[model samples]
Target chain A: MEHYNMNLTLKVWRQKNASDSGKFETYPVKNISSEMSFLEMIDVLNEELISEGKDPIAFDHDCREGICGACSMYINGRPHGPWHANTTCQLHMRAYKDGDTVVIEPWRANSFPVIKDLVVDRSAFDRIIQAGGYISVNTGNAVDANAIAINKDNADAAFAAAACIGCGACVAACKNSSALLFVSAKVSHLALLPQGNPERKTRAMNMVAQMDKEGFGSCTNTGACEAVCPKEISIENIARLNREYMMAGASADK
Target chain B: MKWSELFTSSIGKKWVMALTGLFLIIFLIVHAGINACIWANDGGVMFNKAAHFMGSTVVIRIAEIGLFLGIFLHIIQGLMLEFQNRSKRKKGYEVPMGNKGSKWYSRSMGLLGTILLLFFILHWWHFWVPARFIGHEELTEIEINGVHMHNMYNLMQYTFQELWVVIAYVIACISLCWHLIHGFQSAFRTVGVSNSKYMALIQNVGIGYSIIISLAFAMMPVSMYLGWV
Candidate 1:
């Protein structure tokens, strides 16, 4: 493949803080390599802004390899851009052409408030995880793999559900701003395991309760979350979450 | 933790929507089946007889209350959901990828529901009030095997004869098709039917159900207007 260079117009959301009313600030980047990742393109832009004696745009990134789930910027109208099953950091410049205008903004949901420019406080996810997205198992004693016989299909579903990186892309992509996909993925991964049995009764209820407490919208089953999900987590997990909630509610003494 | 939380929470609100929505789905099927009897072409006697039994039946009369409740709860929850969803995003994208992002109906459920609401009011005024409250004395009442039945068939014929009413009904049914297309599978999904195999089955059934019910509904008025039924 021949190496190509393109000049692009970047329209980015600029906010001084969560309290500040934000606006789009446009800048022109010249001679950008086609092979650079989307975040890398932003880096180049930031470097330019810094050299021009201006404050660099703030965005979040830890594992640019698409593992951390930290790089969640809504490119254009689609979350994580027009790419499918890829995060913002994994997006390449080749998806765009010369003279194209790229609009970038942070995840838009009341639950995930904007902390700075492109970095929103996704700690709501953390709060959900903390709210019973776990299991209690004794450690320091290595058990045989055969100790727990897991079904092949259930194991695969668990693994797939576990692939959720806690990124807010699912929320960003949702039309209703629902977090069912993310919470369901977390719930499914644990509920499928024998170890997750003890808390299974309260897990879905508590997490969903917390999700509502955080002011996230309800799932309309639009599947936009699954469509934009980097891990391609099945909406099946959401069903599992609902199943868990129903079971918990029916069995709870209260 | 409280019992009320089940319907108060976001997930709970969805449950309310799904359960009430499923009830309406069943109601539509029954309503459509009964309305389809107009095609019997037996001087409207059979249709009116059946309508009288349904109207006089204690079970169905009680069910009418439940049906209204279901519709009411569905509308209330749907509106609340719409408001919450809109508020969740205080700011929307300047360049929205509308259809590219998701199906238009999925995003427009609120609008469709509102249209259906107006349709419901018009529908009740045209049919229910006369049959139940105002009395259907003006129309001919036919007695079948000593059981008197309201001449709803004539009422329907008169209602559907007007082009404007027919057009309104046809438009309402189209809105209903979109609503059912999203609502059917969505209700199942909300209730936790997420397996790939089951999801596909439910989606297919949903599509078929929407098509049949919508076509059945829209065709009634069209058929009446054309004097076929």
Candidate 2:
């Protein structure tokens, strides 16, 4: 692996809370290793903050692995830094040149209010999911996984949908703030599988209603979500979600 | 806000966008088909008859309401999604790497959409509103073989006779075609039909349909102006 030492300028957002007006504060770091992950660089900055008798900048993180969907940051203009299918934590300094200036900010959206510096409230996503998702599976029954016998085709589709980590990266990448990619993945994952059939209609209807209620934008058929998705989720899932929604709307009176 | 439930779960705003987009796709196909009928005959008789029928009582009223709702839902949802996505973008670090996976049109849907909106306004002002309220006299009147037609044919011919009008129509058709190319497949994908086994086939079919319909509709006026049936 290629290694290099680099000096960098960081312009980071500083926010006290959701209501506070945020601003960018610049910090300089010298002699950073090329192998350091983006979050590790933030860790170094936070350490400096603590040493300076300042409150360390707060940001969300879990699983330093890219799967948890907790560490969301817009690097430059793109959703998850520069690398395709990689999250902020997975982004290595090698992707940047020495002496590069990096601007780091929390995700900007009305629905995702700023929680603090570098972290925003993404809980609107939860309300949408809770409104509709998951079939009313019985707790007592331990049905064999193979017993349901999902087609390999459906299984593959579900696996693709399951790849969505709920990162909201798609929302960030989209110009319209559309969440169709994320929601459709979830809907399609279940809808394509027979196991999800029982609640398919309700799931589509309720989830869509919840999404609209939360004041998210409609899909414009732009593939930005797929473009920036850390998991590389396809817009196909969104189409599936649409089909499910139509069917659900048609049968809503039932 | 329950943080655990939000980022950890799917089935949120994304699905709503997908669904609404797909619905609009259906509407576009139907609308394109209706518009294509304008070029079906040498004279505009068949087209005007069809337009008249479409502009008739019950169907027209239902279509008006549906169109309003459809456009409203699409715009509202599109804006919300953009906002949500904006909130999730990573902060301040430029990547020199070019966008690899997305199609050009997919990335530029907003621009195309804006163009389409402008076209819609012009379309309404030129055709729909005048046809509905102003009648043919204010626009242009045409009589062919003793038929007291509304002169929609003459109007179309006259409009396309202008070079700028022809160019505008072509540009609008291109935009519509590009929009539909992505929109059609996207709708299918959102509704869960994206399988690699048939993904390319479906994409091709979707693109074909979009191009054919948009080109057919756009070509009607061009043909009229060129005096080519």
Candidate 3:
């Protein structure tokens, strides 16, 4: 197999701060190996910018692989580039051809405001998770792990829901900027488990209420969130969230 | 926490859309059933009698006001939501995924709604103004055993004979089908009827209702166009 190299033009969003207006700045990177990941290609451009003593483009990343999901970029009009259920870190350069111009931008939802070039302050997500993402952890002797016999299907579904990495890709992909997928994933993961049963009602209600407070738009079931979610979290999780919230609202503790 | 939050909040707005949408759906059912009586082929006797009762009855007259208000509320709230959703993304993608990401009608609800609104205005112009305000003096009046009634069936027959009006109706019914496809199940979801066991049932019911009701509506004109009735 012969190695392929491409010279690409990058139109990257450059934002000074959260309050600053942003614009796209063009940069050219040459001789990029097709095998390099999309982020690694960006690294080459950052290296050149640093050598010239210019402020390098700022972005977020942790694991180079897809799991961490710290890497998020709206590349060429898509969250995580033009790939099915992939993170930006996992996108390889071979997806592009020589002389192709790639446009990169930060997630554009007001709820996930831009912090700098291609990086957004997704802390709103943290607040939503903080609202009710955790289960009741009673301070006592450690409970036996296998004490609760969980059904296999429920456990599998819960595990699938738990795979979400809080990437905000769902918000970026949603036309409404809705956090339904992320909130649903968190809600469904815990709602399916016995440990989560105690706070199930409040958890569902509070999480949704928090999500609403964050100014995220409503979910219209466009399925774009699931389409772009690296975890492939199902729309079924959203349905379950609605179920939980409804049950909570109708519950009468008085 | 404010009372206004029930209409302004995202979820509250959803509640308004859903409740108004479902209420309008009930109105559609009753309206469709009554119109279906035109198929009785009894020279519009039963249809005219039913129309007379609906027009003359005070309870139904009061409910008609609620129906009109519900429709207006649904339209206004839907426009607000559509604008809100649009404003959420101030920029457009360089390459939209289009149907690859979501259904066309899902994203085009605002556009479909506008079409429906225009169609509805035309609908009211053709029938409602004539029946309620113009005194039905010019309309063909019939007596069924000495009971006075407007021959609404003749009104419909005359209305549907025009090809353009029939075409407009067919297009309007198509839009209604797509609107109901998402709206029906979505309304239920917003109201918290999202149980997995029953959601499948609800979805099927939604699709079934969309197809049957829209087709029923479209057929009214198509049948008249073809002189089937």
Candidate 4:
């Protein structure tokens, strides 16, 4: 790729805390390299702000390589910029050109309130996981890895669903602000395996109940969540989740 | 899970949508088939007989009640879901991402449903109210094979004669087309048919169903108004 430099304007959201009504503030950066990651470009802008005796824009980021699911910027009206199946940190500044204006905002959902500039409290996801995102463990001896014989296709799909990084992108991208994709991914990740079978019914029931209690909206099958997910979490998992929930609801003793 | 959760929970709400949506899908097929009777072009003989049978039978009458109930449940639950979903996002984005993440119709179900509701009101006023309440005293009473019934085919002809009504029905059918295009596969997905093989088949079948049903409906009015029937 040919390296180039460009000047750009960024309109970023600024919020003091959860209670504060946020607004966008624009700033210009000069001579930004196209090779820099989107987060690195923001770092340069932040350094400039700090030098000018201003509050630097605070955004969440870790493992800039894209696995951590920490970076959650809604860049240019997309959860992770315009790239398909890419994370915000992995997005390159080359996606833009000279004199371009980029708009960046945090994930906007009632359940995930904005804690500060570009960082919303995503612990709601944590609570949902706490509800039932686990399988029972026997504390004594380590079991053989080959003990559980799994089918190859289901194992691959389970692996794919497990790749969801707990990012709030699916919620951010959904028109309803629904967390179904996240919950479904979590559900499918475990439900496909025999180890996850014992708790499967309660897991689906409780997680969905917790998700609803968090005030997240219901799924409308709009496909937006699948489109914006950085981990390429398939909406097929959502259907599987629905199947699990329905069967559990119908047959579970509780 | 408790039985009440089927009505009160989020996934439960989706089950309601899926079930009611499927019911309505079946209703549309029946409705479109009946409407296609207009193409028989037999001077309203066969059309009025079918319409009379649908209106007068006891079992069909019971089923009509269920149909209305299904429609009401679909509408009420749909609107409530739309409102709850809207409230989940307190603040709006400055730059709207229009149709990049999902198709416009999928996102605009609420708006399309509202339009369909309005069309339903007009349609009921024009056809159903007169047929059910006012009796054949208002419509021209005619007999076919010793069976006397309301001349509903004449009423349809009269209703479609107005250029504005024809246009409105065409627009409503267009909206229904888009609504069903998204709704058909979505209903199946909600009902747990997420396997890739079946989903591919459902998606194609859904597209065909939407186009064919809406076209059949739209043609009823267009052909009547243009004297093609």
Candidate 5:
């Protein structure tokens, strides 16, 4: 791909700590390559900050590859920049014009508090998952993947649900601050498989309880999460979560 | 109420929201069908009779109770879910601004729902309660083909005569339609039909159904005020 030299301006969020007052700070970069990924551009800016005697802007990233989902950013008015099914680390500078002004900030929600510039602690997701994501399979029990022989349809559905990377993008994207997409993905992923059957009742009950405890808003099904999701996880998973929950409630009565 | 249980437990308030939302979808379908009868040109006799049957003492009482429960459950569940979502972000993450993946409606459900709730109260007070308890005095008596008829048409026309009422009704109808488009398929999905093949069909059906219902309902008042019916 041919790379074009581009000039850019960034209005980035800056916070010293969680309790510190935060604000947007503008920075200018000259002659950036259009082929550069969004995070790589940020790397160039951090070098500029450090050399100029300023603290490097803090942000999260693990695998520069999209699979890790470590880089989370809202570019312009979009999550993970403008590319569909693309994470921030994978979004190329080519998507923008030569002298574009990009507004970047941390995900805004009462549930997500900013730890530093462009980084908010996302451990709420970990708490939600720990609530009851997995079935109690013994470590020593080595069951073959084909041993259960799940139907092709169910397996596909389960895999799709499992594709969720526990990214808080859905929550950030929702106006209600609802985590239905994330929670539902977890519920549907397990609910679709046979191994999840043994703890289905407890799983549904526990996960939903954990969801409420975490302070996530209820889903009104506006489908914004599915639209912004890098994985394009569907709202149907939420419905399945509801079904699993209701069935669990019914069976618990017996 | 335990912190661990609320975040970790699966069969809690989230399920309540999903279940109540599904029930309301059923109610909306029945309501839209009833309102559509106003367009039939039978001197409004069929519509009046149907309305009367629905307003009968026993049926009215049952419906009143059900409506109360449905609205109550929906609102309570909604508030609880909102609280839970807020609590989770006590500590924030380092993410950027502007979520392009989300839609306008998804973020505005709270506002839409609040408007719809206000409209529901006014609707009940203006038509439902008055027709049942106050005995439809707003309607005039007319002679139609040697038969004595009640001018329910005139009553409807008069209600829509005020520009504010018409405006409010129009706004409410739009909000209701928006809510239905998301709520309809969502209710289905919550019941566990997330299959890709079927979901696309459901989403389309949901959108079409909401548009048809909103237009059908809005036309009745507009047409009545314009003296077309």
Candidate 6:
């Protein structure tokens, strides 16, 4: 719990654009505070780069609190650095020591093409959400929470699935770049609720169709996604997704 | 969803792998059971009877076609999945995260399947082709209770006599062990057995089944080669 200062070497990925062949560029940071977050360390390094008249690194980060799912980039081979159930924004420099070298790179996947230095286009996730990751709810006053009368276990599981922050860490961690963890989380979050009953079948079917159309790879159940998930989403949702999709295929009217 | 999409969709394709994989899992039990008859040691009379029954019975003969089809679909879909999955990551990581996320064998299904495929081809050539075709010249003819049959026991004995063949078989079984260790629970997971209560059970069963089946298979060749039977 003691704070300390450390000097570190960073090998960061740099690319002009999606079409540009990216390469790693190394930078040296002096006296970084252990109490600073990983992104804060990057911010310090960026400021120094700007002072040196070099183009500062471009990375995606919205909430430094780790909820927005924007903070991404593989730090030393792991998705969000060497922490369990943690994100980049929550990763502190304290995890490292003096004179350690860290290699950072953007998510590597055909579906997630790199847009710039340490940033990839993750709109594929948006499209998959658009493909039935919702329920048909009438616009009106907020419904009473007690009206649903959901099972406690189902509600808990649904909440767990809902914890997914739409981060591409699952896909980034996956060797196949499969988005099943993300898709399954979305599907299970809704599918487990009674409000999600009407379009459950179509939701499962259509979302998967869109997932495949987006050129994401099929899942091989390697548990890599669950391992690197920032929110610690379980692959159990993937099994639920598979079950939902199959049942929908078997009985859907259309 | 169109019926065609049943096999075309990503989940659909996984369903195929799981169903076919489960079928093959069952087939392994039958195979190991029949092969265990070698322990009867009555000069392979029991083993030969079981092999002859499997080869000659009308019901089983028809089922054999289904078995081959199951294996064929499992292999083809496995290859397609592998190739497609590989293309998803066109760019390789600068620093590899080897076995940090999952076990090596879980991520190496393609490699293990390829090894198993090569082994199967040799296995079929050694036993299946001759038992099914190539006439009786290659197989010794024997009669049990007036029921004449090809002596597959002799073929197994003869084929395993060579050290290379025994070693190859054992290596293949080791690969089979690794494959089943992942595939068994994976098949259950694919079929939607996501309940936390059953997950641990399935995982433990998968590991035990993989070891037992593969060990039984590996021992067959070893036993034959060493003249233990």
TM agreement with the true structure for every prediction: 0.97, 0.74, 0.90, 0.98, 0.85, 0.98
- What is candidate 5's TM-score against the reference? 0.85
C-alpha lDDT score of every prediction, in listed order:
0.88, 0.73, 0.86, 0.92, 0.75, 0.92
What shift in Å separates residue B11 of candidate 2 from its native position after superposition?
11
Task: Please write out the lDDT profile of model 5 over residues A1-254, one tens digit for every residue.
Answer: 67798999998888899899888788998888998888989999999889999899899888988888778786776678788887888899998878899888777666677888888777888887888888877798787777778889888888998999976888877766777789889988888888898888778777776766666666666677888898889777887777777677666743
State the lDDT of candidate 1 residue by residue for B1-229, as single tens digits.
Answer: 6678766777777788999999999999989988888999887777787787787778998998999999999998788779878899887776775775578898889999999999999999999988878865555576778876787888888888799999999999999999999999999988888777888999999999999999999999999999997
Q: Runs in model 2 with CA error above 4 Å?
A: A132-148, A192-198, A252-254, B1-157, B160-164, B187-199, B209-229
TM-score (C-alpha, index-matched) for candidate 6: 0.98
What RMSD value applies to candidate 2?
A: 6.2
Docking class of 6: high
Q: Write the per-residue lDDT of candidate 2 for residues A1-254, one digit (tens) a residue.
A: 88898999988888888778778888998888999999898899889889999988798889989999999888876777889889988999998888788888777656667889888788888887787667767788798877777788779879989889998887766655667787888888888888788888878877876776665556656577887899988877775676677666655664
Q: Give every candidate's TM-score on chain A.
A: 0.98, 0.96, 0.97, 0.98, 0.96, 0.98
**Judged by lDDT against the true structure, how good is candidate 3?**
0.86
lDDT of 3 by residue, A12-35 (tens): 989899888878899999999999
- Give the distance in Å from residue B190's predicted Cα in candidate 4 to where it truly belongs: 0.1
lDDT, candidate 6, A177-204, per-residue tens = 8999999999999999999998898899
DockQ leader? 4
**Clash count, predicted structure 4:** 0
What does DockQ give for each predicted structure? 0.71, 0.25, 0.46, 0.83, 0.40, 0.82
Error of 2 at A210 (Å): 3.3
Better of 1 and 2 by lDDT: 1
| Residue A122 lDDT (model 4) | 96
lDDT assessment of candidate 6: 0.92
